[model samples]
Target chain A: MAKRITLPITDEDIKNLKAGDSVLLSGTILTGRDAAHKRLYELIQNGDSLPVDIKGEIIYYVGPAPAKPGYAVGPAGPTSSYRMDKYAPTLLELGLKGMIGKGARNKEVVESIVKNKCVYFAAIGGAAALIAKSIKSEEMLCYEDLGTEAIRRYTVEDFPCIVAIDSDGNNVYETEPIKYRK
Target chain B: MEIRQIKAETVTETVKKLFMDCNYFIGKDIMTALKKSFENETSPVGKSVLSQIIENDKIAANEEIPLCQDTGMAILFVEYGDKVVIEDGSFEDAVNEGVRQAYCDGYLRKSVVSDPVFDRINTKDNTPAIIHTKIVSGNSIKITAGGKGFGSENMSAIKMITPSYGIEGVKQFILDTVRTAGPNPCPPIVVGVGIGGTFERAAQLAKQATFRSIDSSNTDPRYASLERELLEEINKMGFGPAGLGGNTTALGVNIETSPTHIAGMPVAVNICCHAARHASATI
Candidate 1:
């Protein structure tokens, strides 16, 4: 059975989750991808004020297609999470509670997830159209020039995901595949 | 030989329709393979993910939207007939214009950047598609088009192996590449291997192999058997659907080959995600 949870996930929420557990997330989350992450990292390095608050926020790594009429977003599946590995640890250190993306994280990011009590969720990659249905509304947050890669705020309802990496550093990407290997 | 005059507008319209249709509709071969994988998948997580993917495809087709957000860089493999003459505009321009129309008017995401390293600005309409054209003997044009999302594209690899490396060398390289790609390329991935060509030709053949239908096999029997064997080995890796874990790591393995120099045997592996959007047209 999938666990239902809301956004602004707390340390207690992270603690209870385990690798490979299915989850359905609701409430609000922020969206960012490769380009957006680069900018955010730069802002952190320079100690500049961020356009959006990171404390207690969950970030979804995605660059959704433009929505057609009567749709909130278009094909909004997660992008490859590893591409943001360089910047993920920094964000996690800043109180970002969770991340929703596909694929594995590097060693540093995994260590940071443990240290910061953060969780990493994997939304089904290439399941964009279905995932988009969970996003009820979207508003551009910043970096509009990046087009689809821009940062945005999304209100989600029952967004499906799996806890790929739990706060204790248990990682599905590392452990689950071993069970099925022939 | 009579020249068949094809209007530029016809080319534009055809390309536009191809891009839009390919994005909206998941290929029948891929759908069938996914269904088979779903039935065969053992892991509960893998089964659920496959089910969601199948559902996503249906919704995209019925609603006329893209199957994935990364609608991909436009790639066209053109079999141009020597006796056919494109009127009013060059074939390249027509194709790009078609891409522009489909991306802008069809509401597809414009993912193309104007440059790679410098001034990485979005071209906005996904114009200037990557086109591979070959002049053939017939009087008609056959086009195989695919929107190649980079998630899997980034996992592709090419290598130069000597003839001494032999068949075993080829198999090892392909498997190694897939292993390295792991969960990143969005399994169950389609593995496209190109053997016995020059470095670049090998890469091109690998990409073309990906555009081939998953249900189809290589014409040569030995290569066909190689495809089957590789598929089995890859499935054993347990990458499964969305790479969480399962028995069906790869939905299909395709091998395309060409005769090469006695001294060199180059191979390339092109990985395509489960969506595997491709379509073909003849004119």
Candidate 2:
């Protein structure tokens, strides 16, 4: 039987996650990407006020297209997570419960994810339009001038994602490929 | 010279429209290659992956959605026909306007930053597209739109020298790049190789190579053979979709060659994921 989940995820709940676990995420997710992440790290390093409280929230590594009339955003989907690995440990320490992206992460980020009891989730990499459907609404939280890189709060519904790396430091890219590899 | 000026705003909107259209429409060449991927995928897992990709493309096109999440850095190749002139707006500004509208109105991600080393700030509109302009003897402008997924973009590189190395050296370089790329560029990639140009030109040709239809063959028989050989070797590495493992890794290989100085042999490989998004327009 598959595990059913609700929001307000805690570190403890995150620790229970394993690769291939199908998760239904709700609540608030903050959107960021390479540029946004670098700026966020700079703020944290400089002790500046962050746009949102980072504790126990999921952060999506994405930059979406402009929304059509009556739409919140366009073709929103995850980017490569590894590019942001440099700053991930700090976010993990800041109480981030989950990270969203496609593709694999480095060893250090994987270790940090495990240590922080955070889950690295992968939304379908290229299904931007499909993923866009999950975002019920979006509100710019910070860096509004940054446009797509702006830290926006999104309300997503049944956003389908796979657990690529679990809290135990198990990596789907490394281990799973070995089995299916000829 | 016939001179005509286009309103900057209109040019901008056109680029945006192309961005949206490219994601929704998979050209015949690409469609054919993807279908072959479905038929030739030896592993059940790989075949299933290919089918899902096909299904995803259909859903994206039918739903007018993006084929992949990394709605890449918008790259434009502009060919300025000799007799035509764009009025009011500079060529660069016109291109940027198109990028902004595509990213903003069409809801494509704006992936570019103002700077790379410091102050990595998103330009917001995915503007300042990586534009390569050429002057040709015609009275119209043509733009090629390409949205590269990040997984493949990160693996692109340029190398210098090693001519004494010849084809064997080139082959080794390709293998090395793939081995190092691992799961990063997304397996089942279409690799674009550029031979014989200045370093940057080689890079440009490599990227240009990706915009060619997947099923098209290199007119040069030598280049075509190189393409086939490289594709075979890459698959032997056992990197499957998302690097999950399978017998098939790459769907195709493309090489764009240019004449270069005898002293220089610059090579570049620009990688493109299966969700290769590109479209063409004339204005």
Candidate 3:
């Protein structure tokens, strides 16, 4: 059975996350993919204020499709998180609590995550339809100009995801594949 | 033969409809690949991911939703029957018309960029669909299209004059590409390998071959055998779903080959993650 965890997720809680554990992330998570991160990192460089207070907040690396008129957001899912590796260490330094996306991360970023008491989660890629059910509501926080790459705030209801990378530097991607490799 | 120059407006309208339907329908070949993957996946996590992909397809179909968020840059393979003539205007224009309407009506995100390097501007309309036109024998036009996203496209590669690296060389190249690709391309990817042809042609073939049904085998026995072997090897890498580590790094391996210069073993590998977005129409 896949174990589920609620959000405002603690380091200890995320540290315990294994590859197979099914996590239900419920909290005030932020959405930012490549473009927003570029801007956020620029803000860091310029010492500017972020559109949202990211301290202790989780960020989902996603570029959601355009939502229908009445919907909170469109088919929202995580984009590959590694593209932000160069900027990730900077974000981690700013009290970035968690990241939800798929795929692996660089070793340096992984170390920063461990050093900064951060976490990384994975919502099933390509399960956009099923994943959309987790969002109870959403608010466009900033970067409305970036289309799907815009920054937004989300309220999730037992949003399902998995912890792919944890603080101990025990990456599920590295360890799990070893077990399965013939 | 009915001489009908379909209005650019009409062609455009029909293409958009094709986009909407393709996103929801998981093709037969992809289905076969999933089944095979589910059966052979060694890692529990890998099996689970494949299952999720399968379930996602079902959910999209039943719920009438797009299968993946990256609905892709709409690409069209238009086969105009030699007898059928479009009277209204340019075939390309009609095709783009279709893409614009489909994307707009379906509420799919406009992901295309007019400029690749600097501007990175979203074209908003997802306009100027990539159309590859080929004329065939019949009267009706046959359209096959897919929404291709960045993750897998980023993983695509073309190599010219790679020497007789033989089977091992090819295997290493494929693995190396995946390793270098890391998580960007999206793991548990479907790799379409196109061997032979000029560099550009190889890459194009690789992309075109992606539309091939997943379970279909190459007519060449050697290539067929290699495809199976590569599939097993890729799974052994244990790249699992989203590279969180698992037995299923890839779902299947497909190879398309054509005669080429004796000295040049030009090859291309195009990666399509599990969200294999594709649909076809016979109009």
lDDT digits (tens) for residues B1-283 of candidate 2: 5566666666666777888898677667767877887787666656655665677778678866666656778888888787765667677887777777766666566677788887777676667778888998877778899887767888888889667988888888877887778767756788888888788889999899999877877899999999988888888777676565576677788999999888778888888887777888888
TM (chain A) per model? 0.98, 0.94, 0.92
Give the DockQ (2 decimals) of all models. 0.86, 0.42, 0.67
Per-residue C-alpha lDDT of model 3 across residues A149-182, encoded as one tens digit per residue: 8898989987878877777666776776666667
Of models 1 and 2, which has the larger DockQ? 1
Q: Which pairs clash in the backbone of model 3?
A: A173-B244, A173-B245, B5-B86, B5-B87, B12-B97, B12-B98, B29-B214
For model 1, the TM-score of its B chain against the native B chain is: 0.99
**Model 1 per-residue lDDT at B206:** 97
Candidate 2 C-alpha lDDT tens digits along A1-182: 33545666776667778886667676678899877898889999999977789888899998876665666677776777889999999998988888888778888898888788889887655556667777899888888777767898898877767678898887777776566443
Quote the positional error of residue B131 for candidate 3 in Å. 1.5
Over B99-126, each residue of candidate 1 has an lDDT whose tens digit, in order, gives 9999988778888889899788999999
Which candidate tops TM-score? 1
Candidate 2, residue A97: lDDT: 84
lDDT of 1: 0.93
Ranking by DockQ: 1, 3, 2
- Candidate achieving higher DockQ, 1 or 3: 1
Per-residue CA lDDT of candidate 3, range B134-233, in tens?
A: 8887778878898988878887877774567776777777777766665557777888888888887788778877777777888889988988988888
Q: Mark the regions of model 1 whose C-alpha exceeds 4 Å error after superposition.
A: none
